[model samples]
Target: MSNSPAQDTLAQDFVAFAVESRVLRFGEFKTKAGRLSPYFFNAGLFDDGAKLGRLAEFYARRLVASGLQFDMLFGPAYKGITLAAAVSIELARLGQNKPFAYNRKEAKDHGEGGTLVGAPVQGRVLIIDDVISAGTSVRESIEMIKAAGATPCGVTIALDRQEKATVTTATGPQEAAESAVQQVQGQYGLPVVAIATLADLMGFLDVQSDAALVSARPAVQAYRQRYGV
Candidate 1:
């Protein structure tokens, strides 16, 4: 596919519609780190088939636009599994002819048993997911991908919070997570890419001109101040 108009449209929607729509509740949320966060972009809220389908289309568009050339798309178990199925279908719809696979949390004992389900993975693999918080899952995924005998080419996700610090340290969990991304890329030669960053979501909130958004502007700004790398 030669990156045509339709491709461009989908890429745009990936950032504006799919990614942005997911940023909900720009309010005080006690995060996993025990920090009071002003906003959250929970991909888990897309709890229906239609929303997931749209999300997949955008993900496929982003993968194409970002020039992530992969023979197989690997989604981690559970959430990744659903995302993988939807994205594979969207990619097919977009004429990408891509195959996708995901793993089980535990390997099945009977039938065609394996940790991984769906198509066989081969060549450079792209690991897809909703977000990257601490990157514990990402590292685990790398190991799993390697065990499956496919080289990880890249990692793609919907949103990048860009708040690379999550604790009181000079560098916190978010920093550590970003450091992990760089380290993975540097050590393993794999690139971790995202559709939109924290700034994009903040911008989207600002443009709405709503009071909730207006108030959130400051908290998000403070978040960037405190956590930004």
Candidate 2:
């Protein structure tokens, strides 16, 4: 869970911003994996112009700091569309301009007449997204990038839950040894970077004085101990 000093600072700051923006909430929330999580992070809640722009800056900063060389960016459908556009803008503002593209959920019948929009998929492409749970979006994106003959260099996400990935079998759900992010890295042999993680959230709680925020730490810790990777 250790990060470089720059990454540590950014993760802390991003966690604070997320809390203030109400994108991250501490409570009993149901996860897609059917677990009751102590906290929830909704990237879609970063809806306003200022908030979205700041979120993009965090992404750009993390990607740039990671030293991952990417020719362009590719965003999967839905959530990623906005992230890719805004991050591309912020990276350009930071003087590392790069072409970015996104896929539509369905193919367009007319006009450009394809699933992909913006610049053509080419070269080493970085996939931007909010987080990896099941990693369905990342899988789809990798297929698209490879279909276009582009190498999927890496993936940059806003947060890493750092919990075990799950699978369904005859007995029901079972936890995997690797988290979703770890699975992606192993399966594709590509690096995965995150701006913040569950560890960073716990770290934030450890240093905070607010009783309300600090009180949630026990539940979060319990959850991590039980299910975190």
Candidate 3:
């Protein structure tokens, strides 16, 4: 479904915020998958309290706008922990208080812990993260939720790259690949919501009068044309 006018504005505003925060950068950068990308978004840059708080606001807004209902939020190890905590706080501020949880990378052998922490995993749970380059994190989270007898209803992320995903087949590998977001939805039958996308970033760049941004637009567009879903 298409976003409403208000949602579109918020998405654009997020792109602006990302640029100002230097979280979204335009340049030549190699991805984990070994592809050189024109632009890169590093959620790890939102490290300070103020930056994290503002980032959470964008996530909360997108989640509410998505109309996806869930009983709780689950963040994976590391980055997911911060994202889940911050988003829960923001959601509460937006009048939707929900429990949040996270897991340790290794199972803790002491204290009140096994692997999971925070609220008990129950009902429909939403997994929050910075991005989904591969489906591995999401798969791990799904297993954890099922192990706890909780249902994983959806996933929320800061941005969607919308690039083609490579997959193994019986013969060799599938040349026709789906995007990471598409793979998650197809495999799990759950919605993946993002505050912004590559398309939105390109749109933002398109309207800018800055010489650098204007010059960088074609590179990003070319990358999208080659790999976008």
Candidate 4:
């Protein structure tokens, strides 16, 4: 889908906010896949009330603007729990009230006696998450939603790394030559909407005069050229 000027501006603004909030940092950092990345984005760092509030606002705005249809929100266990709730509140504040639900990593033996929590998982559910590195969380969320009889319709994340994903096939592991977001969209037939992507980050840095950002551009660009989708 083509991004409107407003969407482009939001992407730029989100990149700026992430840097200012220190959620997106420039430095040598190792990913779970052991790739040395020039930059790191830790959504967990948006821990405080204020930062989370703003983060939710960004998610809400992006989802609303994307025009993805959904009847409810579903957050996976752990980080997604907070993300789903916060984004739901923010969406309601923006005049869209939707039911939100999440699952527990381990099902309870008492009380609710199940994994599902919050509002019942229902209708076309949109999954809210920080990022989709390996697509593990997304898979789990999809399963949970399906088990609850809800359709997994869309996913909204803070950023899209836009790097190729490795998948294990009958022949063995091989690069998918597509980003995790792309794979999710293809495999599940669902749209993955991200607030920004590696390309957007590059664009954000392009117009910046900050010496640090300018200096880091080369490394980020090289990394993208080598691993980007």
Candidate 5:
């Protein structure tokens, strides 16, 4: 990256790579939470060294570009565990080695065992993950951070799917999610940061992508209309 990246460079690369990596895909799929999504971003698909390595690089770059301040990073469980580890490692490769920790869904009841592994979670902790859908994970992660005697700072994700509803009829998913993320920030003083949002995705798709997505845009728009905050 250059000293000054182009406007929305992070957003563009994230959307492009996400599409290229197929880590996040658009299809009819059932989520763990049982919501039928027209699109899904499965971070678990980031399993190889190259893909994982690139992902961390992007995450690290975004972090630097974001100017977020935090003593540590936290992932929720399972998927989050891997993301946090990779991003922390990538940051280290950039000569900014920051300690990282993650939780196991089932805790080990033995000596030297605790919910969080690796460095002890201390001071301000930023939660990193793939995306924020309904904000459930964000809320739970906040509680867990407080439980560990640390301050939950902000959330960084590859994307932000605005699922909250908006008041103005013209407001779309982006606006709704912006509202929800703001509420969360106001409630806990923590920000939800993402590389891209619906607007970014739409912007990329509108001019360069296929007519299929262009024609199918309304379903996504409808989803935002119904569920956006």
Candidate 6:
């Protein structure tokens, strides 16, 4: 829970980067949990070559700084596919070469084909993704890693909402005690690391000079108070 100065700075910078890229937008956005959020982070917007390369740098830096050991990276599917590949390339560029693999949404039935692609999953594999929303992707990734006879060391993500997860009940949707990130950590016993979190976004908003962005700070703070873990 204690973040070093460098880590804090990196988080702040990442927030700024997201904003500049228009990947992190301030507006009334409906979440999967059905809560109205003040801001939204869309990692898929890191589309172009330069943006993706820079985004990967942030991920690699945070993972390395966390000191979590992993022999390879596993991207679940869809969004994570690009994230894992880019991060692995960044790590290798930083002189820490590591293999990475990703899963297909559906199993293929062709030459050298299956659900998995790229390097074989082995050893302490780290799951990479954009964020932990419902935690479905992380769960699936863990299952695949174990099936491959690999050990899942931990998970790395771009942002942590840090808000309690929602569960559908007979009464209606209800908030759980722990966030999606927390659920993943507790359920699978793996560390869920992030480059930035909701708290960091709040911090960024506090010092932001943009009149429009600053005006949304109150809404963000209220949302965090209502649902933060």
Superior candidate under TM-score, 3 versus 6:
6
**Winner on lDDT (1 vs 6):** 6
The C-alpha RMSD in Å for every predicted model, in order, reads: 4.0, 1.1, 1.5, 1.3, 5.2, 0.9
- In model 4, state the lDDT of residue 127: 94
TM-score per prediction, in order, is 0.84, 0.98, 0.96, 0.97, 0.82, 0.98
What is the C-alpha local distance difference test score of each model?
0.72, 0.94, 0.92, 0.92, 0.75, 0.94
- Judged by lDDT against the true structure, how good is candidate 5? 0.75
What are the per-residue Cα lDDT tens digits for candidate 4 across 77-176? 8999999999999999999999999988888999978989999888899999999988999998898889889899989999999998877789976777
- Candidate 1, residue 161: CA error in Å? 0.8
Worst 10 residues of 4 by lDDT: 172-181
Q: Is candidate 4 or candidate 5 better by lDDT?
A: 4
Over 78-164, each residue of candidate 6 has an lDDT whose tens digit, in order, gives 998999999999999999999999999989999887899999899999999999999999889999999999999999999999999
117-176 in candidate 5: lDDT tens per residue?
878988999999887655677888888889989998899887766665233355532334
Comparing 3 with 5 on TM-score, the higher-scoring candidate is: 3
Candidate 2 global TM-score: 0.98
- Candidate 3 worst ten-residue window by lDDT: 167-176
Candidate 1 TM-score versus the reference = 0.84
lDDT of 6 at 73: 93
**Model 4 scores what on Cα lDDT?**
0.92
